[model samples]
Target: MEPTPTKETVELTTESGTLRRRGEWVVPRLLRIRSQAGAVRLDMSQARIAHPVVDIELSVLSGSIVLVLPDGATADLDRLHSPHASHRSRVPAVPTHQAPHFVLSGETYTGALRVRYARGHRRR
Candidate 1:
């Protein structure tokens, strides 16, 4: 008697173009991204996010949102402002009691918000 696997909640909305999350997707516990001008990319670095607390909410006006993880991935950000546009994270924010916590709230007006962490060694 063994059966346990149920976790999925991924909401995505776009009003202009591009919303992509590739491969064996599995990173949802409330990942909502809304855009008006277009462009939201989430490449889970091969895929596998079984949730531990991942709540990512984003609302963009001009367009552009990219999040790619896989390198001991860990994220916790809730401070993004875009008037002319430009917000970046190269992986450096992990302290919310830690346990696979990716909580990111967002609002970009002019566009461009990126969080990328995928470097070296990946060949099983």
Candidate 2:
């Protein structure tokens, strides 16, 4: 069977801020940007993606932030490195698994991303 095409979108809300969804393959990568006080914060936490990508790229003009990822999330190349610092670094890649199942706002932060789609565990 042919694979489904990827769908990308960014969600914005006054309470949480901006969320960017890119690639719904096996692993779903969610990006979020919010104004904390007067500073913009970038967070990629609890990103329960079906497919673990080899690399991800992010840049900023002026700001300080942290990325929250699950314990097993691997950026590969430099296991102990800031692999998420950019997409062009040395990192082992992860296969994309499935389309985003459970809908949770990263900025909204419902729970562990790994459990976001735990409801559909019986599908396959």
Candidate 3:
């Protein structure tokens, strides 16, 4: 029998200032953000997706939050509930009507939340 896949969780609990993660990395199943008066920025332009589904939960009271994904990544924001927050993206996200999906949830009290997609580079 095949083993069931377990979800991985990455948490960020900062009081002030900014937290940044960049370069080629692997994405976890769940990303939890809880900033009291700080900012968090994750650049996943060269990240590797091990699973088909990933979830990001943001809970920022103040400051700002940003998430950068690859060009072909798909995002599902139906569970996101941020009344006073803003989500910005220049290019259109690939529809999450298929297998692989990235779901974003949770809420922000008085911070700016943005999700953008950057085009990946081709190696020679």
> lDDT per residue, candidate 3, 50-117, as tens digits?
77778888878888887877655667666777777777654344555443467788887777877767
Error of 2 at 100 (Å): 14
Indicate the residue-level lDDT of 81 in model 1: 52
Candidate RMSDs in Å, in order, are 12.4, 11.1, 4.7
> How accurate locally, in lDDT, is each candidate?
0.75, 0.29, 0.73
Candidate 2 versus the native: TM-score?
0.31
**Which residue pairs clash within candidate 1?**
none
Candidate 2 stretches with Cα past 4 Å from truth are 1-45, 76-124
Candidate 1 segments exceeding 4 Å error: 1-9, 14-30, 35-50, 55-57, 62-75, 84-102, 105-107, 110-124
lDDT of 2 by residue, 5-117 (tens): 43343323223233333222233344323432222222233433544442332223222333333333334222222222221311123423432222222231121111112
Summed backbone clashes in each candidate are 0, 15, 0
**Poorly placed runs, candidate 3 (over 4 Å):** 1-7, 91-100, 119-124
lDDT of 1 by residue, 1-124 (tens): 5333546666789899899987656777788788899998888877766666678877788888888876556676655556687888877577444436677877787878888765573533
